[model samples]
Target: MSTTQNSGRWPHEAPPAGQDRWSWRPQLLSELPLIRRELRRSLVADTSDAAAEQEEELHERLVLLMDELLSNALRHGRAPVAGLVRRTASSWLLVVSDAAATVPPHPDPDRDPARGGLGLRMVADLTTAYGWCSDGGRKHVWAVLAPA
Candidate 1:
């Protein structure tokens, strides 16, 4: 596997230090629904004092972002895929890691939406900050969303 820390055009950074973190392993695509449910539950439990609608929207965005990154790892990266959610004072960080250190995220700006590779682009646009890094033979892709 390639040892390149951050192989793509995006910046490289580790998951931010936070108040709490949750981690899980996701090896199959079929587990997405369960993952989403658990993520929502966790968000609701550890959530802030934000307005109800805003909190719901944040949960939705986090779930969708996790789905995209975790699905990509399951479909293309080598197992076992790891997922993490970290809640900091100002943001929530979502990270997914796999054994495919040689294969970093590829975001094609010119790709057609119907071709279905636009998730990462949407993620980049939606998040406050996002990037990936390879460490200890695992490639980690992470995104940070404001808690608001």
Candidate 2:
């Protein structure tokens, strides 16, 4: 079984003064493992005592959500492009950038089972909320998880 320790809230002091309170940029699939590790570390480092159990469950859910989001991006978002995942004071955002300008169709529960289109539905269920945006040449699909 996986174990986790509660680290309080994310440190507001990590970023230099006057820097964007938020961090953002494009990311690659190869960076996902490291991102997961950093997210856990950030949680542990931020929380105080008495948060271990809560953190553990939150971490578990976050991992599963991340896996689902990334998998959907790779399998359906189309194009081998970069993405962005950001953590803010209130929520964790998973952003997958792709070349497709078309918005993803809403999950159809009635579609034929053999067509294989349940990933986003799972993502929608797992996350606190999710949506997508397009700009210039890229489409960004994002989901948010409330802070633990």
Candidate 3:
């Protein structure tokens, strides 16, 4: 039902091959908080010099980004949603996948700002790079956050 074109490789940049990768499959929306907690722990476990305030800020940003993508998959895309974070030396690749392989992500251009449909644009602004791809009957939406 979405008008978005089926551009399998939007932006055409591939996710990096990182030194480490963490992934989770959340079947319910209520599992987000726990997932976020685990993700935060993995992200900051090695950064001993990170200030408390900076850590908190990073947590907030991670929650916002993850929530937006996962919620979209839960609401619009098919189930069995998975979240992946690949950590390289200086960057992190965040990817969310759902079974809706044929349905591409649609960024509504005409939605009212007050009504809350601009999440895709917000994701684009927050990430250094972003794109989507369809592989193995799953649609993967990804973003790269550098200076990880």
Candidate 4:
């Protein structure tokens, strides 16, 4: 709930106890393209020395993460009210809000892949850090990307 002011410390410091958190809400599947575009812009703006190639690579990774998050929301979040993706000065948070209260389970790396389910693990590997929380009647799954 506490406002994350410093860019470098986000995703590392837990939110302060009892503060209204800031969240972004996006609606409709069509809106995802726009969201992706905006995310790329934000990434570019936030990085001081990102090369064009590096930016392209980051953009691709962001798109993949976004796709995974969106797909997971649609498939598992159980009729999500809306999808929210938030960016702090230091981290990115992806939230898929559903009426369902259950949070996504963490991936078990040792489990046999034949059983399926690897999205969360991919997310963890791709991002700097990731976590989730459920409160105020919504569930949020999020990941943070380190500054380029």
lDDT of 3 by residue, 44-94 (tens): 764566465566665567667877888788888998899887776766677
Q: Please identify which of the two predictions, 1 or 2, would achieve the higher lDDT against the true structure.
A: 1
Better of 1 and 4 by lDDT: 1
Which of 2 and 3 is the better model by lDDT? 3
Candidate 4 stretches greater than 4 Å from native: 1-51
Point to the candidate with the largest lDDT.
1
The CA lDDT of each predicted structure is 0.82, 0.57, 0.74, 0.59
Candidates 1 and 3: which is better by lDDT? 1
Ordered list by TM-score, greatest first: 1, 3, 4, 2
lDDT: worst 10-residue window of model 3:
1-10
Q: List the residue pairs that clash in candidate 3.
A: none
Candidate 2 lDDT by residue in tens digits, 3-118: 11012111111111121222223245666676567656765775666877676776667666665666556666667655454666666666666777565525665667688876
lDDT (Cα) of model 1: 0.82
- How well is each residue in 18-135 modelled by candidate 1, as lDDT tens digits? 6547777987899989999998888788767665567898889989999998998998899999999888788888889999987878877778889987778888877888888899
- Estimate the Cα RMSD of every predicted model relative to the unseen true structure: 4.6, 10.6, 4.8, 7.7
- Model with the higher TM-score, candidate 2 or 3: 3
Better of 2 and 4 by TM-score: 4
| TM-score versus the correct structure, for each prediction | 0.86, 0.62, 0.81, 0.62
